[model samples]
Target: MTSIRRRLLLSLFGLWITVWAAVALTTLDRSGHEVGELMDAQMAQLARVLREISLTDPQPAAKATPQALSAVGHPYESKLSYQRWLGDRLVASFGVAPVTPLAATIGFSDQEFGGARWRVFGLPGNAPDEVLFVAQSDTIREELIHFLTIQALKPILWSLPVSVLLMWLAVGEGLRPLYRLARSIGRRSAERLEPIDGDGVPAEIRPLTAALNDLMERLDQALAAERRFAADASHELRTPFAIIRTYAQIARRSGDPAERQAALDNLIRGVDRASRLISQLLILARLQGEPRATGRGVASLVRAAARVVADWQTDAQAAALTLTAAAAEGEPGVVAVPAAALGILIGNLVENGLKYTPPGGWVQVAIGSGRGSVALRVTDSGPGIPAADRERVFDRFYRPPGQAQPGSGLGLAIVRRICDLYGLRIEIRDGADGVGLSVLVIFPEPSGSPKAHPP
Candidate 1:
């Protein structure tokens, strides 16, 4: 493939050659015609003046002297020659025209004298009996044009070398910034995510460097997240795996049915915990690139919470805890949400409430609105989170102080992902009347114009 610079140079070169060719041909045609006409007129004029030599006056050679030819032309430049018919014999000087051997002696016409061609005039005014002829060479026309072409082209041939040098310098100057950017990247370690120094960089290249820096930052985060995930997975998997191993050993040692049954129950509990942790991890993974709009009724914040709490109530009944939801009236029946995400949010909050609250204490899921945002509040009769740890609660695998619950710690991470996706805000605070923890998820209302489509 040809480079752009070479292609541009070739195009310019072709144009210059074409222009010079046209100029050469046009100059040759115009100058040749003008010079030829001027030469022909001179010859005619010379012939007329010579016919005034009166041979009938006895000594005509007196007026044909070299000084007498001074009125026609100089001796060196623009050659002029003459011929006279001295009694049917021809005379001549150096001329380019070949002999016109059969020309008639009319009043004014072309003729041949000696060995050269001539323009002649047979006159009856001054001498009724004589004819005169004169001629000049045509080589001066070609000589003048050839000299002009050489002078015009001399500078052009020399300027091409200078032009190429200038072009080389300009291209290097233009590409200097690109070379600097490459050098900056080349000097960096692969593990680093530091920003590029944008000072002295051109505005045209700033956007490219900024984009590369952004990509590096994201790569750093992704690597960190992967390490955290591996550690968290190992810790979570170790618990259930140990319980299964212990239960298997016990079942093998015990021959009685009752001991085997006890071992089976331990195995089941271990499996349940493992399953929940796996499900929560799966949720976090899915939420890495989760799609947001689930427009179903199940995606409603209050409804989803009510269902999750209903399930939690049945589970907590065996542990002497009460689970319930307190939905506000006159609120929109079903808000648009991502259902998988909303379920994760509602499930985590309600479970935390049930776990921390004492038996006979109530877990309330409330929905209300104020200040252009709708609120989903989960309040309970449990020890509330500390102000310092409240900010950190949404982190993956994080637990509040004095917490004893067996969890993978990914619950609030899932919840926070949902909250971020739905534009909802999460807060952990003392409940109304200062008894327990309150986690409220505030959602912004749709723009008062919900568009619909046929299913």
Candidate 2:
């Protein structure tokens, strides 16, 4: 149930206590040695002093006068002691325990004799005194060692709880940045992918924040691309889809042979239009970062559009639609595009223009180059897209509002996708004094002028 901080504090506290305990034990041993030496020295000094005092006076008797001896060695109030001896008998004393084993030899402070414990030391007297002895106990040394051990250990034990509190505060402070990041993230919605500000984040957490921001940017781009695709597809497919439905209903209800055949023809054309729109949708997918469209080699815009235009003329004439091609004489005939892709690019433009133009309306295709670039244009005399809807018309499956054209709406999307693949640019605008829409494609003239493959 103990937390990490408490556990660490306890561990440290226990280690410190163990260490100090060892130190205290070692101190006790040393204290015994020093106290023993001090007791021996004091006892020796007292015994020698007693002997000198006993023998220094003028005395003919070998033994000190009993009164004189007693005066010198009565019980001293402090730990000090002195005793006098005859040849083999105790004569006078100071602080003498009743059962002290005081003898001729120097004695230890822990000796026992009779019925009591004593500390005693004996020394030889001068000319007249036979021997003098001194002794004291170690009670004071034991009390002092116990007091020091208690004082030194009290502070170390009491400091652990306070140390644990400080440690918890530091840990929480260190994690404050993470808390801030979490709160910031919690405030965001699923649709919000804006990058978070990473300034002032700790070095250890910077990479994490940066990674999340990168993910948000990618999600934003993906969502935008998806929205664009949906809007574009909805716009492009609406026209033909309506045409197919209307003609189908007409065919279903009509009993007149000629009217039914006309409705069937319109329905067939609607199917073709739907097919073209679907193909353009596929191209748009390719243009949106697909790997298959990568590295489409360059070709001549003149030759590429010529082939597409020729095929479109066969269809345009069959539909009683007018088609034309215009190009500069002996000028550069090359455009930067892949050969196969070039056909789809021009064919879609020409076909769309022909389909939307009235029976007599003309579709003009042109190719020309100067100033390090080639320009390809498809111009038509059909009802042109309004200036306001020019950009929107380029969206996949998009047909301008109120547009009555019977073609797939993806013609411009196909044109835009191809342009992107070849590093070309395209725009739709009023043609020849704002007559009908003219779709323009400008291709960059590459250095070393890439050779055009024969189509």
Candidate 3:
């Protein structure tokens, strides 16, 4: 695996090396040019000095055979040579093969003599027929250039280790914050969902830290909700089971047939209550577990409400209550919800209303669409919820005091959860004459293709 720190270090080191290489190349080039210019100047100066010496000589030597100068001299002097031409005769020569007119051109020139390349500077002699030339072998200048280049690069080559060490240290120091953040996360307990501290964190990584904190907050809430649900379920189910056991014992001990029958009936009622509570508990759990609605297709609110009324018609009649459903005329009565979700929502509301309302009372389920909103409203001619108790009614297993109703108190809670999942808005108010409860669920505009249907 490739490490981030290693990559960063390598990138920085490569950049530094590249920059140094460029500078070194430029320095070497400049040093070669300057050294060449100095050597050329020395050759020209030697030529001038030879011309002056030949002009001042009063007894010029007679022309003789060419002779090689001594090999022992200053390290550079052995490479130097001079030639003088007087009227087409070699008057003097040193350290090199005799050659007439060492260079055909006048100023500075390069020529091969004695199997070696030389830099030659030719000067006009004081006498019109005399010519002077001073030449140095190319090897001498190359040696000097090589020496100077090595000297120039010594500092950079020697400092490389120190520079690399410093770079490594700097990179490590720069990354300390990230290391601390990683350690902080690694040290956390699994159950600890608290947000991480943002203090001392680098600005570049703030977004990452913020996202982590947001996720932790959400997880904390979910865990808390789960814990609360478990506690409530255990507490609520305990009571019904205890009553069922008590009634069963009473039936076993009773001697009169009618008394025993009454005890059995109570036991059955207790069992039924426990069964309903368990069923509601499972439904609530499923509703919480399922993913939230995406409003993928339009569901007919009128159809869902009418279906709930039809299914509950017998129950309504058994309770001696009139339950009815209607849709507004000339409206699609569509909403952005699934058909099953709409049915569950309406069914819970109508069931709650039927269970609470007195005999001869009415429960109305209506679907209306207007003003860019679709609403499913359930009105019951029952004792209305007090204004203070409206919000608390949505809590799990919370029942109002002084209400002698056989209920698990989960119907409205389930409806509220469904509304929250689908982004629906619910409102509670007094029914007609302020004597009953009115529950209204408002949904956003219909999504996808909506099909109109009658109630």
Candidate 4:
């Protein structure tokens, strides 16, 4: 597993080392340049002093000691060399004097002598042909530059451990709040869905905590919906179960064959009602957990409505209701919903319309496409719902007052859930001529059609 702290520390250390290395190299270069300039100035100053002394004494001692060339008790004293000449002949020599004649050129110049490279300064003596040369070995100058560079870089080396410790402390302090938040969340139980306290949270971490709190809130809502579903399912199932048992008992105890047959028929109806209620409840439960549709599945609204109308035509005929399906001027576009979900949505709307309409009433399923949207309309010539109870009918198990038709009250609720998942718009209003109910559903643009035909 990767660690944030470790990666942060590694990145910081890498940057720190890179900067230090650059500084060290710059310091070394600057130190070498400055020291070389200073050493060259010293060589010029030594030549001037030697010139004055040679002019002061026209005649000098034949034997010259090595110490005469430079100051005693100095670390680089032995590396110094000098040559004095008069009338094109060597007069005195000291230290590692070269055997060959020194260059006649004046000022400082690099010359190879005494089997070593030297920085030499040439000066004219008092006599026309007289000259003085003072020189230092290249190795001595390099050693001096190396020593000064080390001294200049010593502070950075000494401060490294202290700086690293401070950096580690700062990084740890910066991440302490995140660690605390993790611990706080880890301590929470599944049953405890209270919002996390954001009072002391850092501004950088506020977004993370806010998102987590939002997720917890959604989870809490889902759990509540599940609980309500459980309670409502049990309550609604109890009535049908009791009714079925009573009918079965009556059928068993009745003496007349006609009475027995009636009880048996009622028991069969009760079982069917119970089964339909269970199926609708299961569908609602499945849809409750889906927050949104994938929008990849596509289905034709016209086709789905036609299929639903066809499936219920027999029932409509038996009830003396006029059931018909039609499409508008254009072929209805595909909708971004699964074929099964489309079937359920249209099936529920058609069933609900037929259930409420009276004998000889007409129920219509219309499909149309316009303005990049698909509209599915289910209208019935039944007694219309009041404006006050229109929205309430979409709530599960909700039924308007004085309704004689038997229903689980979940059809419209299931329709609403599907519309919400697929981002469809639903509107309820009076039917044509203001006689009954009309539910208009607007579906968004089509994503695409499937390669295979929709089921």
Candidate 5:
């Protein structure tokens, strides 16, 4: 894995090194140019002085020979050379000066003699026939240029380690906030789901902390729901299991055949009720486990209701109840929820109505599509729920008092969960003629093609 600190440090270090090298090279070039100009000026001035000295000597031009100059105390004296020429005969010379003319030109020029390159300045002497040349070795000039260049760059070169140290410190200080944020998050326990402190947080990391806080909040809610579900399941299952066991014991001990048969029938009904409770618990758990909204496709509410009504036809007949489904002509009743979820929503309402309604009552599943909504209504001629208790009925494992029907109480709760997931609106009211319970679910008009169906 790549580290942010290391990448930043490397980039800064490379940039510093590049700048240092550039500055050093520029200094070297500039120093060399300035040194060459200064040396040329000095050589020219010396040649002019020599010409004046020869003019003031008051000596014959061809016979005037000055004393031979040698190195005094300076290290550069040996590298300097001069020649005095009267009509091509060498009259006087200095350290390492050759007998021949340095150059044909009367200005500064470079020449090679005595196996060494020289920068020579030539000038006209006092007499028209006299000439003077002053030269310095190219090697001495080059050595001086290099020495000056190094002296100019000394400070920059010496400060490299200090600059690197300061840069590292600055980069570390800039990244300290990120390290603090990481440590703060690391110190948290799983149950400590509170939002992270936004104070003093760097702007770059705020979004990440916000997202993490949201996830933790959602996880906390889901965990609380699961805990409630487990408690309710345990409490609700105890009664049915005890009833079945009691019935079994009665059947085993009864002497009369008729008594035994009655006990067996009760035992079967108890087993069926327990089985249904378990099924509803599992369904509720599965529904709760899913995300609030999923990748479900649009489906026809009318078609799903009709199918559910057909599936429950036999059960309705056995219970001595009439079950029917209807939809207006040209009304498709399209809804955004998936077909399978629609099935569960309609199935739960229908089952609730059928379970509560007495024999000889009728249960109706109606679909209606209006201007901006598709509505599903399940009405049953049963004992209607009180207005005060209707809202409470959606709570898990909450059965209204005076309810005689055997049920898991999770049916309406499941229905409510489904509606909430897909933004469906539901209402519980009295049936037609105010005789029984009616559940109306309003779905927002769908806009997509149908893709899913109930299993």
Candidate 6:
């Protein structure tokens, strides 16, 4: 596994090392130049002093030895040498004097003498043909330069350990918030779905926490919906099963054919009601779990309505009701939705209309397009839902007051859920005569114009 802390430290240290190396190289180059300039100045100054001394004392005492070139007699004194020439004769010498002229030029030059490289400075003497020369060994100057460079690097070497310690501390402190967040999530109970607190969270981590909170909120909603579904299913199915069992017992005990027939019919109706409730329940569950569609296919409102109307036609005739389906001429009536979802939405609406409409009443399913939307409308001549109950009717297992109908009260709820999934606009209002219910499922126009096809 890759570690953020390790990666950050490695990157930071790598950059630091690169910068330090560059700085060290630049410092070494600059120091070398400065040291060479200082050494050359010293050699020139010594040569001038030697020329003045030669002029001040033309002759030396017979017993006097050549003065040591380095007055302080330092450890590097042996590398320093000087020579005084008077009229083609060597008058005085210190250290190892070269057999040949140390420098042919007037200023300074590097010359090999006595099997060693020397930096020599030559100056004109006070007398004609008199000259003085001072030189230092190249090996000694290099040793001094190396010593200075090491001294200059001492601070960086000494501070490295402290800097690394501080960097490690800073990295750990910066990552504290992430560790806290992980611990907080790990400590949470599975049943808890509350939003996480954003206070005290680092700005960089706030987006992550916010996304986690959103996920938790959605999970809470899904669990709540599931709980409500389970409770409603048990309550609704209990009544039908009880009724069926009671009627079955009555049918078994009855002696007369008429009584037994009535009991059997009631039992059958209870069984049918229970089966319908279970089927609708399954559909609602499936719809809740189905992933949102993401395909280019278009659903034709006209075609879906026609198919629903045909399927329910026989049922309408059995109920002694008039049912019809029609599409507005010249209207595309096409929407961007899966055909299966559209069919389920239309089927529920038509079924609800047919179930509640009284005998001899009329029901109509119509498809029309207007102003960037396609509308599939189901109108029934049943007693219309009151304005106050209209919104509530779409809630699962919510039955309107004083309505005598054999239903699980899930038809409109299913329609509402499907409409929400497809982003369709659903409206409930009075029918054309203002005496019945009309449900309008308005679908937004498809992104591209698709030819309407039959379902």
Query: Which candidate achieves the best lDDT against the true structure?
Result: 4
Q: Write down the TM-score for model 1.
A: 0.60
Tens digits of lDDT, candidate 5, 20-74: 8898889888988898999988888888888778766646445434345444668
lDDT of 4 at 168: 97
- Model 6, 1-455: lDDT tens digits are 99999998998899878978987888788888888999999998888877776767867433323555567767687788877766556677778766556677777888888899999888888887778889899888788778888888889888889988988999999999999999888877658877888999999999999999988887777888888899989998899999999999999999999999999999999998999999899999998765455444677777777777888889999999999987867665778877788788888888888888999998998888778777888899998899999999998999999988889889988888887777778999999879899998888887765675534
Give the winner by TM-score: 4 or 5.
Answer: 4
RMSD of 5: 5.5
- Which of the two, 2 or 4, has more TM-score? 4
Looking at model 4, the pairs that clash are none
lDDT of 4 by residue, 1-455 (tens): 99988999999999989998998899889977897899899988888888888877787765444445335567576678888877656777667776555566877889887688988888888888878888888888788878987887789889899989988999999999999999989988778889889998999999999999999999999999999999999999999999999999999999999999999999999999999999999999999998887575787777788888999999999999999998965575578888799999999998998888999999999888778787888999999899999999999999999989888999999999999999999999999888999999998876555423554
- Candidate 5 regions exceeding 4 Å error are 18-157, 167-187, 294-296, 328-333, 370-372, 446-455
Please state the error at residue 69 of candidate 1 in Å.
18
- The RMSD of every model to the true structure, in order and in angstroms, is 9.3, 13.5, 5.8, 4.1, 5.5, 5.3
- Against the reference, the lDDT scores of all candidates come to 0.68, 0.72, 0.86, 0.87, 0.86, 0.83
Q: Residue 190 in model 3: shift from native, Å?
A: 5.9
- Highest TM-score: give the candidate number: 4
For each candidate, give its TM-score against the true structure.
0.60, 0.49, 0.69, 0.82, 0.72, 0.75
- Cα deviation at 81, candidate 5, in Å, is 10
Ranking under lDDT, best-scoring first? Answer: 4, 5, 3, 6, 2, 1
Candidate 2 TM-score versus the reference: 0.49
Estimate candidate 3's alpha-carbon lDDT, on a 0 to 1 scale. 0.86
Q: Output the worst ten-in-a-row residue range by lDDT, candidate 5.
A: 446-455
Tens-digit lDDT string for candidate 1 (1-455)? 96655666676667767876786677667766776677667666666665654334444442232223445666533244554544444432223322331235555455444454444444333444444555444355466667666666668667767866776666667668888888888887757668888999888898999998987787777667777777887887888889888998898899999999999898888888889988888878777654454333224566677678877878678668777777667455345575555677888888877877787787888887667666888888887888899888888878776778777777778888877766667778888898788887777755452323211
By summed lDDT, the worst window of 10 consecutive residues in model 1 runs over 93-102
Clashes of 2: 6
Per TM-score, what order, best first? 4, 6, 5, 3, 1, 2
